[model samples]
Target: MLARVRRNGGTAEEFIGRSGPGVQARVPVVTSEGANKVQDVRFVGLDGPGWLLRGTITGTGAVPGSTDAWSCGMRLVGR
Candidate 1:
């Protein structure tokens, strides 16, 4: 599985982790844009068999930009 965060003119941080009964690992993320910051993400699995990922990100560069985006709902890896 792959996750990505994109910004208009600034950089983005990245973090990857595995959540399951027998899976525990931290993966590194690579960035393609210049001066883009990247970091590892941390997530916790809930008691109801669900994973929750939360983090904060800051944006830089000129404001007042417009863009369209699409997203998929969170899903459990294994059930």
Candidate 2:
């Protein structure tokens, strides 16, 4: 998954164990012919009895190894 992102001109960081078994990527936000904009995005997945959850996060909450309230809360829930 990380390779795929990089291959397409994006950067990714993977998180594991206590923080995540997920990926955070900074990908191009433009598809046009001009200068491309890059934005950070996070992808997280969780599986429980007969159900699965996948989340995509953006904005300020997408900081890598984030220590904010929302990021902390998510880590607790994921565990």
Best by TM-score: 2
lDDT, residue 62, model 1: 11
Q: Write the per-residue lDDT of candidate 1 for residues 1-79, one digit (tens) a residue.
A: 2233233222333222222221112333456765545343233233453644542212221111212121112334564
Off by over 4 Å in 2: 17-19, 31-35, 75-79
Q: Write the per-residue lDDT of candidate 2 for residues 4-79, one digit (tens) a residue.
A: 9899899998877344688989987775777679888888777879988787878877767676566545643445
Q: Could you tell me the lDDT of residue 53 within candidate 1?
A: 50
| Candidate 1 to truth, TM | 0.21
How many clashing pairs per prediction, in order?
2, 0
- Root-mean-square deviation of each candidate, in angstroms? 12.5, 3.2
Q: What is the lDDT of residue 48 in candidate 2?
A: 75
- Go through the candidates in order and give each one's C-alpha lDDT: 0.29, 0.75
Worst 10 residues of 1 by lDDT: 61-70
